[model samples]
Target: MINKNVFNKTKVSLIKINVAVVVSFFIIFSIFIYSYFKGLTYNSVDRNLNDELENITVQLTSSAIFSPIVLKDPSNMVYIYEGDRVKYYTRNGYFEDMLPKFRENKKNSFFTYTENGYTFRELSLEIGKYKIQIIRNIDAQINSFKQLIYVFVIGIIIAIIITYFIALYLTKKALIPIETAWNNQAKFVQDASHELRTPISIVSSKLESMLRSPNSTISDEVELIADAMKETRRIKKMINDLLCLTKEDSITTLNKEEVNIEQLINEISNDYLDIAEVQNKKFNINLNAENKIIITDKNKLRQLILIFIDNAFKYTNKNDIICINLTEEGRDIIISIEDSGIGIKDDEISNIFDRFFRSENVRSKDIDGSGIGLSIAKMLSTSLDIDISVKSKLNEFTKFNLIIHNK
Candidate 1:
């Protein structure tokens, strides 16, 4: 089962990632493009302001009379303050001569006025002691930048939304092969496991029966037959492990019904008790649940419980105890199986449910394990929408938890 902290998908969620990436990229790109064009527009406006100022300067410097003059025009209004003689001339007020306190502004200056709407440069010079000043409004450029910035921000938002769907479409196309490969791999493992089971079972059963028969046709054939049986058993054990590894959720859907959880556990406990007594082993059940009613597939759920009980009996030594606990953990129904004998190593516990995975330590001990018990349990739990997990410590205990959803 997947943790709640991280996002998980039974199938790949590539579309979500693709949508996020594309939208993020487009928003950043739109900002870059907007800034690029806006910067170009600002540069052009600045150049135009400079040219207007330069042209005014040229017209003023070319005048022959030393008298003040007003140059009236559509784009600009010029006023010449006849200095030293205290003469003043006013036109459209596009240009203004600085007072004597601002005499240094006769060279180059920047100023703003609310009426014309500009903070612009004033290029003025002394012409026969009459200061002629040139000025042009930069308000248009300022307004242009403000409006463009607002539009750019809005455009980026709209572009990001549009890019999300396009990214989803593209991601779906790219992930096709991955989906196919995953399905094929799962199908292959499932098929291979099914095909191998019958042969391995026949070999093991034949070997066991042969071992039981002390009196055979030929007396000399005992040692030879025993050796062959040993090899056959070993081969069978390996194949069982392979089959366990390949198991999958072949059970499609369940005819779900309201069953008493305690009753089911009790019935499985009774079956385990009989089997354990017959095998000269021991088993126990711990019922911690106050409630018993649960809606689920009775057969598959029973199979899962039985497999755990059987596995504990098979692996444990004679008279070893196998514990089964049915309880509630938060919203989930927690069913746990703890065995006293042959607990798995800490490192191997994680891979224990994997198809054909037996611990290296377990293999060294040469205990018979097809390794499919946990795998089948896992698949069955998955089909039933239950979560299964395990924890084991060497020589101490091994525990399996089947956590069923409340729904």
Candidate 2:
């Protein structure tokens, strides 16, 4: 059984996980797109720089000069080369470093230089003694690439948020039918359970009277009928409990009125006191108040008490002691029933109230019960806004405490 608080938290956590996964996918896809575009832009810039430098170098070398000398246009990047000495130039002389490197060591026509996230590629050739080097402004190109990346990152984030909302919308649309199906299934089970209860009760009453008739003869057929009746009652009770398990708040036109708790407890205890004698057990009732009246439904509250008492007797061995105590606790009536029988085991305590959950120990003891007694009691107790708690130790004792609010 799951705790209500834990179940709620689990649901929220699952939703959070789903949202996180969707958001993460959105972010990742956006980043991939941004990187692809950034790379494409950088490649385009590099190609343009190379093409422009190659064109200017071809023109400058075509003209003959003395000593193979190179003239530096520390202005427009057009170089007139004469021989080996190379000088840098650009349209804006201050932007000379923007060009990529053209290295001399490889004799590979061009070489590259990198500084501050920028790559400078330079090429040089000689017509005379002066060797003019054409430098591409690599740093500025990279800086342009970086700016593009930043812009794309921002755009991607905005797009991802938008995508997240779309995903949420689609998921909600997909799950709407599931939620509706769950509601309908619950309603069907509740209606079916209610329909079964009346018929089962009628059959049980008829079986009872038939078994008690003076002319009735004990036979295998009669015993089989009794067994079948018991099974039918058991199934009916299970259905009732399953209906209760659903999340329907009974339209309880709860009529609240003043009632005497102490007198009610005393009366129930007295009614059951004679049963203990016939069954070879002990029943003790300790009432701490005279007229402990409060607002409640008399019939339902009485039914709840009877269920507990019935269970106490059903599972107990002969000669065991059962105690009922009624007391006032801070503006509330606390009714406790404690029984000394083969009490519930620690492992079985939580499931004891579950429908059709008969313990192995009880089964071994050969006790007869439909196993929905505590479930019905719990349902009624909850409807009446009463708190029910149980403390049971195997081979020691089992106790149920019912607290009713005075108001």
Candidate 3:
């Protein structure tokens, strides 16, 4: 049940994570592939140059200086020499222009040279009676390598587009729960506003009627005054519950102390004993742990306990037994409130702690509730880092369990 606003926010967040992971992986993979391919091409070029140089040296050795050797024919590029005398040249001025520059360097190696705006790879060699030089134009291979660069760049762009779509699909699939929570939150706001409007309208209408009938004395319209007062109290209670839910610093601003658990339980039970008696119900307390002490926010803990007890009292019928049990297990104090009251449905149990959610059974009974008690309790439990759980059987009984750790 994701609303449009929450869905959009969750979608954006998920898309960012997906895009980051995909882009990082693609970038690393692309770099590795590009480097591997470039290395392979360079090694191939080196091997070809070595083989070509070897072949040219063999041709020079076979053709002795005494023999009339014709170099620089249709395909062969060779320069012949004997000591300081030049026997043959590849072309008119091919050797004369660059041979002096090549002689200045001691290293006999393969290198690139530019002549008249043309690029060539040259390898100079010394034989028995001839110095043969082999030259090969590498402009086409260089162009191919440039083409490879363009292909790699285009491949990266295409990969990014594919990854973007994949990331978008994954993000949508992963954010279902966020969408659901947002939808639930939207419904909660609508429900709360509906609940608030009822009491507010009643209060407004009653006050308006009373003002119109100014001649009516206190005795004449006591019922109207009393009904208005009741609506006002309900509005006040609802406002207080909303405040408890909305207060961001409730847990931080709490007055914490070492509370005597047994004493606190006894005091709360005693205070409710008279109310239980007036309602013709039995209030029971079973203290399984003796002289228990816990460091907690006493007032917040008291409010939590009262909320459970009050909820039990509100749903329980006359002659029903409402029981409070306190126990210690390991390093944690467990407090449970059990009541023989109208229980919650299995399906409804999951949503009981959501804001402004009341079961249909309770609503059918026309019970007076703002439906904010359990939501406030849930918020308080999270703020205090406590665990709270509820177990109930429909039309049978309900129990709330609170686990308070020993700090």
Candidate 4:
């Protein structure tokens, strides 16, 4: 009972959820990898800064206390101290405030400091009558980490966008069958209602007319009663046909046996002979296969033949020829029913098997039919594993071919 709109919405929601989960996993994995490598890079830079500080301490210890340990590298900043007074230092003017406080609270041998929007890694060492402080600027490395974070954010955004579109495409493809079934079910309910409404209304109106004319004698009301009974019978038959269509799958339970194909055809042809005679039509039977046995569901097969013959009787004109032919083509048994009746239009032939479908020509005529017989036959054929096909030219002839695999 699912409607097309709700079915489509459910499909789209599921697709979105799946896309979100996959994209979230990818983003988390990417962030984990980036953070691991970034941590390694920072560790390497810290170790190198500490190693350079150790080398500078070794040089100062090897030299005299007042030997003036001059360093000209602009990237390296050094602070040389003797007791509580500064003996020599590099960039003292730039780090005057930061170095003084750092020297006073020299609790940790290595520490980090931020000054004037730049980060510095500081290492303090006590070297033979001198305390040396070495500083390395790490602003570039911090900026690189920030840039990496930005790149990951952008990549996640793009991935989400791509995943959304991909999910939309896949959901559309996956919902094709569900949407088709939903629409078909809706159409079926609508068609069934329309078909039942006419007969019920006719019967109700006929009975009401009889009720209003209570004093009318039985003879006067006979025609009205007959009309009501006829409509009631038509309604019953339509209901039976609907039930048969619905339970077409039960054909599989039919007691299958080796049935004589020629004899079955001959029997059906004889049964329709009188009906054809009343219409002045020629009903012909042709059995070309020498081997006439086929393993099949006999009762269901009889129903199929009756449906075709009845249709032939209804659609064909007086004196038109109707031929039923049974033949063998290799490993298959083919039963063909061709009628020279008022043939179906080429366009209408394809839809002849649809439920309650009648051709415009057939509808225009005063024919008594519920239009569900062919649909029932088609369903039965499907359940019995038989292939049914049709070919027709407007106003010439219409033919149906039923193929059964002869095992």
Cα error, residue 357 of model 4, in Å, equals 2.1
- Between prediction 2 and prediction 4, which has the larger lDDT? 4
lDDT tens readout by residue for model 3, 1-407 = 34477677777777777677767787787778778876776566556656766665665568665665543233435555667777655553444474434442633676677766555666676767666565666667677767877877777788778877887888787776666766777786788789999988988888898899999999988888898899899989998887777675864576778999888989899989999999999999999985498888888888888899999999999999899999887888889999999999999999898788899999999888989999888877776667988899988999999988887
List the RMSD of every prediction in angstroms.
Answer: 14.0, 13.3, 6.6, 5.4
What would the TM-score be for candidate 1 when compared with the true structure? 0.46
Candidate 1: global Cα-lDDT? 0.66
The residue ranges of model 2 lying beyond 4 angstroms of the native Cα positions read 1-220, 233-248, 251-253
Off by over 4 Å in 4: 1-26, 46-116, 120-137, 164-180, 215-222, 243-281, 290-303, 317-319, 380-385, 394-396
lDDT of all predictions: 0.66, 0.67, 0.78, 0.81
lDDT of 2 by residue, 309-382 (tens): 88888768789989889888778778899999888988998888665567899878867665666767777887
lDDT of 3: 0.78
Q: What lDDT tens digits, residue by residue, belong to model 4 across residues 1-407?
A: 55557866787797879688978897888889788977787677657756666666666668786686655455777777778788877754455474645454764466777877678777776766677777778788778878888888888888888888888888888887877777777777888888889889989999899999989998999998898889899899999898886674575567789999889989888888989889899988889987788898998998998898888888889889999999889989999999998788878877888888988888788677878999888877876788998988777888999898888
Ranking by lDDT, best first?
4, 3, 2, 1
Better of 1 and 3 by lDDT: 3
Residue range 57-105, candidate 1, lDDT tens digits: 5656776566444344334433355665544433444334343223464
- Higher TM-score: candidate 1 or 2? 2
Task: Quote each prediction's TM-score.
Answer: 0.46, 0.49, 0.70, 0.71
Quick one: best lDDT, which candidate? 4
| Candidate 4 TM-score, C-alpha based | 0.71
